[model samples]
Target: MKNYILIICAVMLSQVSSAQTSQTADKKAILSVLKMQRLAWSDNNIEGFMEGYWKNDSLKFYGSNGITYGWENTLERYKQAYPTADHIGTLSFKINDITKITDDAYYVMGEYHLKRNVGNATGIFMIILKKIEGEWKIIADTSS
Candidate 1:
C-alpha cells in the first residue's frame, strides 16, 4: 500500500516536470520568433519580418489606422508606411508579458521602439501566436 502511494507521487512529479520543460521550450521558441522579427525589421527587411507572421489570409492586424486583415494586405501596409530604411528604423521590443493561452498558443504584450533619423516612434502591441507545422507564427496583432 505504501509503495502504491510512492509510485503515484513519482508519476505525478514526473508529469509536472515534463509540463514545466515543455512550457519552457515553448516560451523560448516564441521569444526566438520575436527576436527574428526585430532583427528583420531593423535590417529594413519588411518581407523578412513578415515571415514571423502567419501567411494565411485570416491573419489580422489592428492598428490606429484600423483593422487590416490578411497577410498580404498587412505586408503592403507595412511597405507603404515604411517605404525606406530611415522610415523602417531600428526595431526593439520591451516585452511586458507572454501568456500561454493553450499548449500551442500564446499572447505577447510588449512595447515597440523604432529609432530612426526621420523620428523615433514607440507603441504598445499585443500579438497572438500559435504553433503551426511545428513553428510559431503570429496570427493576430493589435498595436497603438
Candidate 2:
C-alpha cells in the first residue's frame, strides 16, 4: 500500500512538472511576439506591427479614443494616428504579467512607451491572445 501511494505521488509530481514546462514555453512564445511588435513599431512599419494581431473581422482593439473592431479597421486607426515616422516613434514595452487562461489562450498586462522627436507618451495595456494556426495572435487589446 505504501509503495502504491509513493508511485502515485511520483506520477502526480511528473505531471505538474510537465505542465510548468509547457507554460514556460508558451510564455516565451508570447514574449517573442511582443518583441517582434516592438521592433516593428520602432522601425515605423505599421503593417509589420499589426502582424502580431489576429487577421480576422472579429478582432478588437480598445484605445484611448474608443473601441475599434476588425483587423482592417485597427490598421486604419493606427495609420490615422501615426501618419509619419515622427509620429510612429520608437516603442518599448514592459510586460507586468502573463496569465494562461487555457491551453490555447493567454492574457498579458504591460506598459508601453513611445519616444519621438515630437514628444513621448506612455500608457498601460492589456492584451488577450490565442494560439491560432500554430501561432500566437492577439485577439483583443485594451490600451490606455
68-140 in candidate 2: lDDT tens per residue?
Answer: 9999999999999999999989999999999999999999999999998789989999999999999999999
Which pairs clash (backbone N, Cα, C closer than 3 Å) in model 1?
A: none
Candidate 1 Cα misplacement greater than 4 A, ranges:
none
Output the number of the lDDT-best candidate.
Answer: 2
Q: Each candidate's lDDT (Cα)?
A: 0.96, 0.97
TM-score for candidate 1: 0.97
What stretches of model 2 exceed 4 Å from their correct place? none
* lDDT measured at residue 48 in model 1 versus the true structure, 0 to 100: 97
As a whole number from 0 to 100, the lDDT of residue 130 in candidate 2 is 100
Give residue 28's lDDT in candidate 1 (0 to 100): 94
